[model samples]
Target chain A: MTIDASMRDALLGAVPSLRAFAISLSGNVDRADDLVQETLVRALSHIDSFQPGTNLNAWLFTILRNLFHSEYRKRRREVEDADGVYAARLSTQPEQGARLDLEDFKTALARLPPDQREVLLLVGASGFSYEEAAEICQCAVGTIKSRVNRARTRLAQLLAVESVDDLGPDDQTRAALQATG
Target chain B: MAQKRAREVAEDVVPGHVPPAPPRLDRNAQARLGEQLRAMYDDLLQQPIPDRFIDLLKDLDDIEKGKSTGKGTTG
Candidate 1:
């Protein structure tokens, strides 16, 4: 099926967020890019299967997730970089505590099992609702919720975070936290 | 140390006895973690899309347009 301009435009719009999810999932920029490229190609080829007027981002994400599991996961053992190689590559300006916190968060996130991490990223970071994340992960909504809860708990334990105050002083972070709290 | 503590906690619980529930994050703590998660995600979102990705999209567009037709063309 021919990919129309509007569909192409939507695919372009989704790239950044899709890349973000890929990096967070794979923890490698090069691998994430490959995954994004693969996802876009797969989505375009399967355009007929994609239902219009639904969440394109989620559809693209599902494609990426499936690709990661089926294709990338097998090759991971062969090409996996040492843990923290990608995290170390991030250029954080000196004395930037927020960036440091993000680095720490990434480390903790990488420690979670892929299943838990996927749920956390979808429900916690990417702002997908439980139902939406469940649909993407092909699991029950309750399973997604519980996985998110476990992921948060595991992250807090890993980071040694005792209180909300320990999360740093970013106003947006505080506001988002409070809203969810 | 955390792993050891977890192991200790597990060891202390008898088979038939329900141990006290593990400490759960309070609402405030949960919110804080959520905030941090969002912040990290936001930082990731700010990363520039590499030129290669843009180029790939263009290539896909071209192929879809029947400009360059081949089965094994993609890299």
Candidate 2:
């Protein structure tokens, strides 16, 4: 069956977040948008299979993540990114030093294993609860938690963020300090 | 050695003011990292959706409607 009006609107509403997740997971805008296009195509064509009243965002994210794993490395041969688009985006954000720090964080993010990166994005960034992230990843909540933990640890190492001060440019730093201090 | 590092941390996080102690570094770091993750993702979210996606969805809507009227716009 073709996409109905509601489903069409739903799919369109989901495109931006889906693209954000895709971009974060893949670390390449071009590839991420390609994945988003393919995902929308797949979702619209397979509207029959989708169960309504569920979390549509999570569903789209699952599709995008699955597409990345199934075809990302094979299709691109793993050399397609490092194109400086991400770095270019960072340079426009803030002061010179923080921008460089953001550049390092982005590189560190890219270095994470895809699964860890996906879980991290799902739970840490995208506002998905551990349970929702688990459902999207088709794993247990515990597994999702672990990946988030490991992803954080490894990212800290990569960014050389030995302590709170080293986590450069975060406004949340004060709240975190207050909460736990 | 640890105290010195904590002092440096205080200077960064509280600059010119001293903290009672080096407020547990690990948790604060986690929060900061997560903050950065969202910040970066927010950048991606801020980007305009490419026209290709908009056009593709529009085309799908047109095709779906056309199919019902016996005037399919599948192209």
Candidate 3:
């Protein structure tokens, strides 16, 4: 099911969700939007590759995730992840004392050593099954599980959350996360 | 001090499940959270699509069409 005439608006309509997912992945709105734009262009160009009835969101996410890693690799030398630059930049404003702790989350997430973060974001946040994430990340299923578990543990420590439950309480956010998780 | 740090860390990680606060999403709080997320999404969706991106797509389509023509011409 290519993104032909009927699917154009429908696919494009996934932009908000895609953008939100990108922000979750990238940490900021601007970068997330850029990622969405890139994903759209790529998806449209390779429209034939997209099956009509399959999960368009998941497919688009796979593309965006791949592009993010590629871009991250290209800028590996020039940009430093040091002292949580990427994480810090991704942090959203906290709400009074009820802040989302974006910095801590970002730092923790960023420190996840790409492989784990990739798996976690895909499996934990993005709602991709371990199988799907494995396929996307090009790793074995067990590897994806380990990465997710490890990522969860690491995030727990970073966010200082006692358990994963702590992070999953935001209903809307959780719902959003579950779609990709 | 140690306990304070631990508590703070625990609170930070736990969204609404900590002992100090119930995890229930009050309508007001839920509304606020929704507003925040919506605001963020709205801001993003409203962003001007970069001209370069638009241009890039046009170029790609043209090239693809050109390739198709070449194949037909040769065939």
Candidate 4:
């Protein structure tokens, strides 16, 4: 669709965060990125519907989530919903230094139930609040809260972390900041 | 009695209580965790964006300006 300069800027600006959200949702870099591009297209076409003062990130995230769910529905019968399958296979061959640890975390994260992982990434890693996450997930606030809590618990358990507070400025943190910032 | 017992279970599982001092994630641990999270995200963020998407946007911008003619790619 025909887009304005401001709209273009906003879409471009939203790209990294959108891509990161897509990746976190899909767990495959290529798929995540394609989702981002699709989100951009959809957002651009429907830009007029976007309220100017409202949150652009939330809007973009909602679009990405809808796209993901639709894609999931389309592919559910054909493909396994195996989370982080790509990362797991990659790490098996061997990796060095922090790369190995990062892969370990990815695999653990991938193994998390999609609902839990989605809530964790949306709230914990992506910095969306409970309400915003609820909106994105189309669930009750209580549900979102429980999911986040549960996801954090699961991630901690998987990683052998004693607590969610144990999350630190590791490679994942840097990547998130780099993508979002 | 059941309600009270459920509440008690919930309290025990609250994130900070299980690990102790979760709010104050130790600096070193925070650093490492952040590193892992970032690494995973980096792969996604660094993936090459298609040229067509940008070109599509540019064309749209031109069309919006009434300078370009014909339909632009929608999908």
lDDT, each prediction: 0.75, 0.72, 0.61, 0.67
Candidate 2 residue A101 C-alpha distance from true site, Å: 2.4
User: For model 4, how does the per-residue alpha-carbon lDDT over B13-73 read when each residue is reduced to its tens digit?
Assistant: 5545432222443344444555566566666567665675677677777777665334454
lDDT per residue as tens, model 3, B7-72 = 545543555533343244333333333333344445545655555454655565567677777888
Q: Report the candidate with higher TM-score, 1 versus 4.
A: 1
Candidate 4 yields a Cα-based lDDT of 0.67
DockQ, per model, reads 0.26, 0.17, 0.06, 0.22
Model 4 alpha-carbon drift over 4 Å, by segment: A82-94, A163-181, B1-35, B46-50, B67-75
Is 3 or 4 the stronger prediction by lDDT? Answer: 4
Best by TM-score: 1
**lDDT (Cα, 0-100) at A126 in candidate 1:** 75
lDDT of 4 at A114: 71
DockQ of 4: 0.22
Candidate 2 residue pairs that clash: none
Clashes of 1: 0
Candidate 4 residue-wise lDDT, A93-120, digit = tens? 3577857667778787778777777776
Each prediction's total of clashing residue pairs, residues at least 3 apart in sequence or on different chains, is: 0, 0, 7, 25
Better of 1 and 2 by lDDT: 1
Per-model RMSD to reference: 7.7, 11.0, 10.2, 7.4
CAPRI class assigned to model 4: incorrect
3 versus 4: better DockQ goes to: 4
